[model samples]
Target: MRILYVGDAACLPEDLADYIGDMGDEWKVETVSDGNSAMFAVSNTTVDVIIVGPSLPDLAPPVLLGQIRTLRPETIRIALLQATEMGSTPSIRLIGVAHRLLPLPLASETVLEAIHSLEELRDLLDSPRLRRAIGRVEHLPSPPHLYFALTRALEEDEGNSGDIAQLVSGDPAIAAKVLQLCNSAFFSNGRAITDLRGAVTRLGLATLRDLVLASEVFSMKTGSNVDRAALQQRALLASRLAARILPRTSAELGATAALLADVGLLLPGVRDERQPLDPDGEPDERPGHTEAGAYLMGLWGLPMPIVEAVAFHRQPQRSSLRTFWVPGAVHVATALAGNEPVDEDYLKSLGVLNQLPAWREMAGLMSERIAEDAA
Candidate 1:
């Protein structure tokens, strides 16, 4: 694999090059001091990953990264910054560009782990066609009006949860969905959540921001031939189930992963409403919504755990983190709560085959609660 570091030669992850050798992995690391040289190199060579430092001199971070986005959409992008730079204007914009953000003064071990995780996750995609296909997208679709309104509010000097809630309240459908999740068993704080403000407060602003981005983007282009309502209901149900079943710290993350697992179905090359191919069938021939959704989540800079869980939820065996936390919660939720077949062999391998009856019961109860609340 080839990795490019674009920054001052002095600050490049030159030490990381030697560390990569210790791992016994055949990889090459190259550094370019300015955007001009970076662009020149990429135009003539293939690089799997690109790292950009905030200290870049010749071209602005956005300008340099924007060109990379257009030219090497397949290349994973990482933004390296000092802790203080995280809240700067350019930093805020990096949210839309970089796949991952590594704080400076970070250990070489951290960089090593990140690269390995990213490489493994991409390897699990199983479909070269899908990767090439989704790479062509400029950015994952965001609900145009809502996305802009949300971001604009976030940019304001004093923007708070109330402001975001008020903006969200303007759209009844979006407001209703956000509130439903907050009041639901997964995120409920006890009494009741009747207002969008209360919902945002309960979920906290950062989580709400991510939820908006994921849910709104996933909501676009509901397939005309498919049951859009059913699809959405399944997502909410799976999210709630995953949240309930996972540990407290990662509950919301699991919910987000489960919620976005079907995002791939809404993207091109997979929105045909076709039945899922058999679990053991050739992956290239499958609908590949899971892999498709993962690619977008990674591009959106969503955390690796969420992206991995969503990507492999359909076939948990594909993930290396075989512990039954995020991936397991999402897999169980999607299969039991959504209208899909369970991978019995995969479950059995994880020694969770016997646990399905209990999971289905829990998921069934939540499903009924959702129906009653909607009524």
Candidate 2:
């Protein structure tokens, strides 16, 4: 693993290098005192990850960070901030550009944990063949024409939340995704968001713009091989059910995980297990949809919390998170929705077996809600 550091943190009474010294032979850390050196190193070398600090002497951190994204689209970019910058507007603006932000003085454990999680996720998704295949496809992030039309309507002075909700409600797929997201891990109160307008309000105008314009997870054109309606139906059920699971941790987050959990199913070689002999006779090594979706989400710069759930939902035991949060909720949600089987042994191990009946009851409620919505 190669890491690039773009600032000096000696004034914090801790030397970055000393704190993270020689993570053994597998780890290589490079230091650059300013933005220019950082850019030079990035141009000359293919570093796996880049870390930017607030003390850069040359370019402002945010602008340089955006440039880094343009220069190396695959490189994982992270930003460090002084505690003082926590409430600053500039720091807030950079949040979209940086993959993750860490507050300084950076703890050694925190830094190592971040590095390990990044490497582990990349390893899970490191598929050159699938990526090449996806690259061969042209212009994939195309939302329906109506989504664009809705965006235009919202842009007009006369546009309002009611109009947006009505427009969203007209499309079952987008409307369900948005509602599931609003009610799931992204945002949740005790009340279920039953209408599109309520969902729009929860998501707000800014997030709405990003979803319509920047988000690719929802924009893939439906294919003949994949049943679009059934896929979405399952997503709605799993998400709503997942939202109800582990509400103490976060309902919206769990729902978001379950909603997008099966996204890897959209990838090649991860479908119905009826493989006829391949003409080429080449072995296919693609990971399942959970890892594939998590990888794709990571590449697209989705938040780590969501990515963690998507990646580990298949086998929540694989994740190191102790509490029954994202992984636990998604694992149970997937099972309850019939996307996968529940591992009773695993739940028993975690001492959460008592929660199973409540989850089944919630699944029943979700199905009833879906039926009413269809009506």
The TM-score leader among the candidates is 2
User: Which portions of model 2 show Cα errors greater than 4 Å?
Assistant: 6-22, 30-37, 40-46, 53-63, 80-96, 100-107, 132-227, 241-257, 267-269, 272-287, 294-308, 317-329, 339-364, 368-375
Model 1 agreement with the true structure over 1-375: per-residue lDDT tens digits: 788989865555557768878766768788888889999999998988888887677987767877898899778777787767643433345655665667676567767666766677767654577667776655556434675566556545457777788888888887777776566654564688888787777777645655565447546763324455677678767887887787665576677778877777767556333364557866654346777777767666565667888877877777554346678889889888765677778778777789888888898887776667667
Off by over 4 Å in 1: 2-117, 123-128, 131-140, 143-160, 170-173, 176-194, 202-219, 268-287, 298-301, 339-358, 372-375
Maximum-lDDT candidate = 1
What is candidate 2's CA lDDT for residue 150? 54
Tens digits of per-residue lDDT for model 2, 236-272: 5776677667553355456666777777666654533
lDDT at 43, model 1: 94
Clashing residue pairs, backbone N/CA/C < 3 A, model 1: none
Error of 2 at 201 (Å): 4.5
Candidate 2 similarity to native, TM-score: 0.61
Q: Score residue 130 of candidate 1 by CA lDDT.
A: 67
